[model samples]
Target: MSDSVFVGIDVSSQTLEVASSSELKTWQVANDAAGLDALVSRLLELGPALTVLEATGGYEFEAACALQAAGLAVAVVNPRTARDFARAMGALAKTDALDAKMLAAFARVLHQHPERERFVKPLADAELQRLQALVLRRRQLVQMITSERQRMRISHVAARPSIERVIEFLKTELGDSEADVAAHVQRHHAELAAALASVPGIGAASVAVLLAELPELGRLDRRRVAALVGVAPLNRDSGQMRGQRSIWGGRADVRRTLYMATLTAVRHNPILKTHYERLLAAGKRKKVALVACMRKLLTMLNAIAKNGSKWDPSLHNA
Candidate 1:
C-alpha cells in the first residue's frame, strides 16, 4: 500500500468519528482534550497527507487547531460542500462513521484541488479568537434585545415589565461586549481597524466583525475576497442556456455586516453613492444595485487592506 494516507473526522459536541483512507479503518474518541491528544498521536504515526473535517458550528475548532499545531495539514470545510460531495459520490446513507469515511474520500480529492489553500490556512490566533467571541456575544445580545422588543409589542401588559427588564439587561451586556471588542481591536488590531474605519460607511461594529470573521480580508485579491464574503455573483449556464447570475454561499455574518455598511455607504460615501446611483439609473433594481455597491465597498476595503493604505477618494475616483 502507498504510504500516503488521507483522514477524516466527523465532529459533534460529544464524540468524534474518525476514518482513514489507506485502510478504510474507523475509530471513535470523545471530543475533549484527552481524546484530541490521543488522536493527534495516532495521526502522527500514520502521517496522513491531509485531514478533513466539516465545520460543525465551532465543534471542530479544537480538533482542527490541535491537528494543525501538531504539524498536520488540516482542512475545515463547509458542511454543504461535504454533503454535495457525498451525494455526488453516491453515498446516500448518513451516520457519523459513514460521514467520516466520505470525508476521507473528499480529503483525497481535496488534496489536489486548486483552492485547497482557502480551507487549509492557519486558524485565528488567541487574541483574534477572543475578539471573535466578543463579536458573536454582541450579536447574540442584539438578537435577544430585538426579540424582546418584538414581544413587547404584542405581549400582554402583565408581561411587558418582564420583557423590558430582559431587554435592558441584554442591552447592558451588548454595550459591554462592544467595549470589549473595541479594546481588543485597539490593542491587537488598531492599525487594521483604523484603515477599515477610514471608509465613510464602515463603522466600529462593522470593523470589528470584519476583523473577527473575515481574517482573509486583506490577503486575497478583490474577486477572491468578494467571493469569500458571498457578494460575488455566480453564473449558471448549460449548453448555451444561460441562467441568472446570483450570489451564493460564503461567510453569512461577514456578508450581513457588509450589506449594512453598504446601505450607509450608498447614501454617504461618495464613490459608492455615485456607483449606486449609476446602477439605479441604468435600470437596475434597488436590491441589485445595493448588492453591487456591497461588492464595490468590499473590494475597496480589500484593496486598502492589501496595500496597507487608507481610503483615498481621489485615487479611486478614476
Candidate 2:
C-alpha cells in the first residue's frame, strides 16, 4: 500500500472492521484493548494518511482514542454521514464490512479536502468526557422533571407521590451533575470559564454547555465557530429563484444553549441590547432580530474565547 493510504474503521461493541482504501483490504479484530493495540499497530505499519470511523454511540471511543494516541489522524464521524455517502456511491447493502469500506472511501474524500477536517477533531480527554456525561445527564433529568410535573396535573394522588419521588431523585442527581460540571471546568478550563462568565448572560449553565460540548470554541475563527454551533446561514438558490438562507446542521446542544444565553443578553447586555434594538428598528421581526442577536452574541463570545479576553462592550464588534 502507498504511504498515503486511507483507512475506514466500522466500530461496534464486539468487533472492529478495518478497511484500507489503497487495496480495499478488510479485516476484523475484537473491540478490546488488545484488538485496538493490534489495529493501531497495523495502521502505524501502513502509515495511513487519515483514518475514519463512525461514532457508534460511544462504541467507537476506545478504538479512535487508541489510534489517535498512536499519532494517527483519526476522525470519528456521524454514522448517518457515512451511510449517506454509501447510498450516494450506489452501495445499499448493510454490513459491518461494507460500512468499513464506505468509511474508508469517505476518509479518502476528507484526505483530499483538508479544509473540511475540522469536523473530525481529536477525541476529548478523560476529564472533559466525564464533564460531558454529567452535563448530558443533567439535561436528561431536566427533561424528565418537566414531564413529571406535567403528569402531576392529571395523575391520581397515589400516582403523584411515586412521580414526585422520582422527581426528587432526579433533581438531586441533577444538582450533583451540575456540581461535577462546575468542578471540572474550574479544575481544567478555569481560564476559559472565567472569560465566558464575564459575559452578562453566560451563567454556569451556559458555560457548562459550551465547555463540555464545544472544546474547539477558542481555536477556530469567528465564522467557523458560528458555523460549528450551527448559527451560520446556509444558502439555497437556483437560477433566478432565491430561497431563504438559514442555519442548520451542527451541534444542537451548543446552539440551543447559546440561544438561551442570547435571549438573556439582548435584554441586559449593553452592546447586544443596542444591536438587537437596531435590528428591530430596521423592521426585523422579533424572532429574526433575536436570532441575529444570538449570532452576534455567539461571535462576541468566540472572539473572547479566541483571544482570552474578558467581555468588553467596546470590543464586541472588534
Clashing pairs in 2: none
lDDT of 1 by residue, 70-106 (tens): 9998988888889999999999999999999999999
Which ranges in model 1 have alpha carbons more than 4 Å from their true place? 1-3, 117-122
lDDT string for model 2 (30-115, tens) is: 99989988998889988888899888889899888888888988898877778888999999999988989999889988778745
Evaluated at residue 273, the lDDT of candidate 2 is: 91
In candidate 2, which residue ranges exceed 4 Å CA deviation? Answer: 1-3
Q: After superposition, how far is residue 92 of candidate 1 from its true place, in Å?
A: 0.5
How high is each candidate's TM-score? 0.95, 0.95
**What's each prediction's clash count?**
0, 0
Clashes of 2: 0
